[model samples]
Target chain A: MLIKKGAEADIYLEPFRNVLHGAGQGKVMVKQRISKRYRIPEMDRQLRVSRTMLEAKLFSDAKRAGVPTPLVYEVDREDTRIVMEFIRGRQVKLILDSLNPGLRRKLCRLIGRYVARLHRAGIVHGDLTTSNMIFTDEGRIYFVDFGLGGYDSSIEARGVDLHLLRRALQSIHFRITDDAYRAVLSGYRREFGKGAGEVIKRAEEIGRRGRYIQKEARACR
Target chain B: MLCLGIEGTAHTFGIGIADSKGKILANVSRVYVPEQGGIHPREAARFHAVNARRVLDEALNVAGIELEDIDLVAFSQGPGLGPVLRTAATAARALAARLGIPIVGVNHCIAHIEIGRLTGRIHDPVTLYVSGGNTQIIAFDAGRYRIFGETLDIPVGNCLDVFAREAGLSHPGGPNVERLARRGRRYIQLPYAVKGMDMSFSGLMTEAVRRYRDGAHLPDVCFSLQETAFAALVEVTERALAHTEKKEVMLTGGVASNMRLRTMLELMADEHRVKFFVPPSEFCRDCGANIAWTGLLAYLHGVRQRLDDTEVRQRWRTDEVDVPWRGK
Candidate 1:
């Protein structure tokens, strides 16, 4: 069944036995990158195939780095699809604004821990939004959608990732973003150690640059 | 009552006259064309200051009103070149002080969206504002226009203009690039940088210029540039529309004049089952009418600026402004 349709892909849920060897009514997700008719055909195919492969690799690498990501089962680059373990959880985006303040802070911290781990592993979740995160029944956060991310340890890249997260919270969770994001930063510091400071500083810098804030400061009448 | 608005935010100096009845009496603009390169802020400001009298006279002449007949004065107050902003602000303040009328300092970006709403006669919309200085997907939320997505590095129009200048194209690069893109047959690969709701075009612009210098076909380069840039823009707009669940999609700014962008946005809006709107080409670019209209809305809602308080805000974000005129 087509469960979710994202910008560049459509996700389907299939019985575990259909893709894996054994079955106990478990379900696996089959994410297929859809070809965008708006793009040049050859370029479109190239982007989809490459992004599919890149996402799979990033997921695997992140999971190995002590972050909670859905386990990858199979990859089909030719068809631009990936069959992964299904995450049975609610999207944080839909529930974050309603959760109790304490629980929300805890969840935000957990999100930060996973993000710091990913950054430590030289990976950046390019599109780090609440929508891309799932809060499992196990009280853990699973980060998904590495389509826009890459293996970059540079502070600038990592900072840009954090900036994306900050911006997402501001726009989507405007009312409660300030306190939640502060907790997220605390969690990041708790996990990433001293390396977290420079990254966070850079993230602030990136945020100002993105808003053209510095330009105004310099060009003030 | 008549409102005279002056707009000198970038390369253009425009004057618009309007009334409380949502009728634009006159819209006149004189654009500054650079001799060899991009706009020089000082030069642009000088141009506005020098032609301020002439444009004001022309606007009043077009509106068929005398100077003392104007009751309100409005100007694009920020998010633009500092010197250019000051020139426009000074002009508006002078006119208002002499006429003993209230003056409004308008946000240039918000003016674009308001003008679209005024011209299209739509209530609320998920707006894609693409101009030389901005690329933002804006929607009204919480009594203000919130930016759902925007360009991270450089705006889409600037991306096109810089590439055009690099390739030795015309002064304003968007239309010229669009004209050449129609002749291209091949598609060259360009960096597609859509990261969540935000996009980056500096890398794409850099790469396109490099390819053209590397002996790539100009038409092919232009085609690929527009494809990557516009596709990224449209994707973000679609994402914002879906996220916000807005029933209408509007495109504005100078770049809105490009048919390719208009068509892409129209198709996306159709796919999303939302009403699509773009004002006539004249209203798309930077102008005084948008400022005049937005100013009127704010003034009617008790937004007033004294001479001492009419300071321009170069970094005034769209979300910072209170839209008392827009009901919750």
Candidate 2:
């Protein structure tokens, strides 16, 4: 496997390619490693192995629930990384930035549905950055990187996940304001049912309280 | 031996006396209310100039301890408003010099933890220290307090106070919000931002004001706002305990007096099977009693500062102490 290194972890891209050689025609990618330092060799090995196992489990769980996530090809716990299907298109951020408002709205609604599907399966994406989502060449959206993911049914957790997405959309697609964000909420409600509305409402409450605090502090200062 | 601690941090001037043990013989505080807004350093200092002696004398009288009975003098060193800190430093140096006693400068945050230990006896508990001036989740490591998590921007109480103003509430906004929140429903939804162990309140505050302007019920909005913000704090505190594997949690600082916040922390502790310790209302707020009690410990352990060693620091962190660790 050819390993690609980033600032935080190493990514092995060749494992999926080699696995697909037997299938004759397919492209795959792998992101199965977390960097370790300071721990003893044995502890590092254990941490990496456990993290890889968690990632693989998270991937399969999301896939079984029909969430559009990368297909896990192979997981090597000892090496602390996994190989998965290679996404062909760029991050949703790039597309959202370059597209017109209409396309941007469409993409946000699509992303909203995808997120709702994941949360419905009781999985909370701890990190929901724009960079963590990819837009396929065929216009499909795929969620990636379950490194900080976990299972939780708390409305707060789900709300926080959606909040991150909303913030990401607003920050990344700066042109889109509350109206577009509400559209994303509508998409979440449509997919996740009435529960999404309650969750979104709660998320809005959190956002409001946060803003009041800041404005007040500034005014006081 | 008797120890006297002076705390002139933020807008409060606290005076306390403690014995060799952690028993607080007396504790007194003088509060400064800025006419226009938040704590103004110069104005607060002026208030302290006039009121410090009154509070100190009252505390001494309440404790029934004379100036000669004070064997050790302590003062809050930093992580507070500079003008307030100078007022405290000046008092401690003067007292220590006149009384011929050693002075020990204590970190205000650490004093909170130590006082929590005294009041609730959670020796190695994770601490959620939230006040108008500071917000942090702390654990004892390597002899000093280590910050496990903290607000990325404003402190929680300050955030609450800010929102209170937007709601047209009083200056010390937390208690006022809690008072008015009971009348509100949980309908007005807001954002809850907990990024890893760290949290942020800026976005949520902005959204809350917008919703209020749009005619959201003020009471319901206040209730929901407190619920979400307190919930975020609970989540972060729980995460810190889980991460550190500590089974005891301590809540400290001025905001600790809020019943709603206490209830939230209590529930989280219950869910995690961790014992939660909250100091009595007096110790919970910004007071010199905690400082006095904590200084007593340092004095017992032979830690002392010369009379001339009274240097006021505006940003002294709790983790900067060079003490030896005593594990649980």
In angstroms, the error of model 2 at B134 is 1.0
In terms of DockQ, the best-performing candidate is 1
lDDT of candidate 1 over B149-203, digit per residue (tens): 9888888888999899999998778899999999988999889998778999999
TM-score of candidate 2 relative to the true fold:
0.64
lDDT per residue (tens digit) for residues A1-221 in model 2: 54444323555555333655565456667665544332223433554576578878988898887778888877776666677877777887666667787877787787677778888999887667666778888988787777667788899888777766665554345465575677677778889996777898877765544422443344346
TM-score of each: 0.95, 0.64
The per-residue C-alpha lDDT of model 2 at residue A199 equals 90
> Per-residue alpha-carbon lDDT of model 2 for B1-328, expressed as tens digits?
8989998888788999988766788999989998865767778889988998899889989998778888888899876777778889899988988987788988888888888887776778999999887888887754556666667567888888878888788777888888888897555657666664568876788888888888888887788778777777776776567556788988988889888888878866776677988888888888888888878887777676776666876656565665432532
Candidate 1 — what's its lDDT?
0.88
Which sections of candidate 1 miss by over 4 Å? Answer: A17-24, A211-221
Give each candidate's interface RMSD in Å: 2.3, 13.2
Q: What DockQ would you assign to candidate 1?
A: 0.49
